[model samples]
Target: MKILVTDPEGYVGSLVVACFTQQGHEVISVSQANAGAALSLIQLAVTDLQNFDAVIHTGEICGTQALHPQIAGNLHYRDAMHLANLAKAAGVSRFIYLSSCSVYGAGEEEYVTEESPVRPQTPSATCKAAIESDLLTIASAEFSPTILRPAIAFGASPRIRFDVVLNNMAGLAWTANKINIPGKGLSWCPVVHVLDICQIINCILQAPRPLVHQQIFNVGDTNHNYQLIEIAAMVAEVFQVENFSFGHHGFGDRGLFMTFDKIHQFFPDFQCGWNPRQGAEQLLNFFTLTDSIQSHFTLTRSPYHRSENHLFHTVSIA
Candidate 1:
């Protein structure tokens, strides 16, 4: 199938691009340097949208640094809605949007389902929830829009991210010879491997229109959920960081415990191949092979940081 994947150079986007290409799908990538100009450019790019069967949109400004609601809301929420319309205008049948489970927020609830109420507290998550709501409105018999709210994703990517929970812990463990939990380590955190996320997307792409149309699937296994301390223990085992401790006051115990039964029931063949231990091992191997082990796992060139820097440099040059 012919596919259009946005932000192909991003952490998640790069993985989706590689996975789709390896699966023999014809994938076209799109990136508008100016987030503010995305809507206009996408609307004008009629020739670029020709003959694509589906679109997987992974483009958006997101990070710890993207804390401002106004800026993030405009870039992710507004731009996303516009992109959805662009997909429909381009005659694309299937639109797959990558939403985050972070929209569920840091609730005391024991479990979060796709049906759970979203009380997004952060600007990033608020934007994600808003985008999901708007995207559902655009779904139709002809335009089958599917939203996958993936858990905190980990695993090596062409454009790897150490900002996520597990990866961050792994980085600290490898570098600092210790893993520290800022708060009590009981806060629940769910995780999914990057490859598993690709598999979920592939399923959505292949599934019948009736099955996935307007569907929201929390994309991870129930078993994959782990407490922050549990995660620290796993990282400690991998990096052999004996100095693992908890009970710092600054960080509170805000957790996300999501259930994946919806996606599991829909695609029975789907399975998360990488557990925390296995994923940690893969990361360790990656660090060793890339000579990052000696470099103290310091990434001199982070993809997200570089993208922002490049945009600034380009704008300055212009």
Candidate 2:
């Protein structure tokens, strides 16, 4: 199957490109290759601020870990949306948007299904939600548009986000010895291995159009959604650090268990085969590199800083 993957050098995009390319899919990188190739663009144009005072103030006021929303990369973000139309123009079989579960809002509730409403509080999520709405509209019987709401993704990529649950806990365990769980560690945090995400996209590419042609799948089975504490314990086991400990932690990016039963209604064997322990172990192996933003665990380069005023660098997946 032929696939056009945007941000091919990005964390999720790179992982997807590696996975599909390994699987023999004809792949194209719209972000890296040609600016004219952007399917749909995003607006992350705000440059990273240089003032340390501003970072501290924003952190204090906004309570976000990153310096700010990824505004510098907005144009590319916007172009990715056009990717769907480009895919159709290219006669591509499927257009997959690497969306996030953040659109579903933080933490779990009685009901968290695909049919649930999306409240995108943060800029990143807001852009994702908006683009998703645009994508669903251009889709139809002929053009297969699938939006995958993946749980917190962690795996080998250029931009590995240590901010996510499992990776964060693993980073803590690897460095601080105790995994920190905010607020009783009871809230559910749905997770999927980075490679598993690639597998889901590959499935969409391989499956008949009806299974995913214009459908949205919550890219994991019910077994994948786990509580924070449970996830931390698994990471502890991965490090062979018996009795690893953490307390209730707090963050604006809350998470919850998600029901992937709908996707399972089609593929029963769709479970993410990688156990949390194993996943944690894979990440923990890079303990020394965890602290530096250049850590080997990271999948995407931090666009927040640069050696020059130059803001954007392109990677072509032609």
Task: Compare the candidates by lDDT and give the number of the best one.
Answer: 1
Q: What is the TM-score of each candidate against the true structure?
A: 0.86, 0.73
| Tens-place lDDT digits, model 1, residues 1-318 | 998887766778888989999999987776644342233334435466667899898746455224666775666665677777877887888989898887887755778898889988767778788888888998877788888888888878887777676776666665556665647787778899888999889988888888999999998899998887887788789888797656453345657788899898999999988998888888888766666444556846344321222221110000
Best by TM-score: 1
Write down the lDDT of every candidate, Cα atoms only.
0.75, 0.58
The clash count for each model shown is 0, 45
* lDDT digits (tens) for residues 110-226 of candidate 2: 647888788766666666777778777887766667788877776546556565667766655655455556556666777788888777666666677777766777876677777
Model 1 TM-score on a 0 to 1 scale: 0.86
How many pairs of residues in model 1 come into backbone collision?
0
Candidate 2 RMSD computed on C-alpha atoms after optimal superposition onto the true structure: 11.0
User: Model 2 scores what on Cα lDDT?
Assistant: 0.58
Can you tell me which runs of candidate 1 are displaced by over 4 Å?
A: 32-44, 64-68, 245-251, 292-318
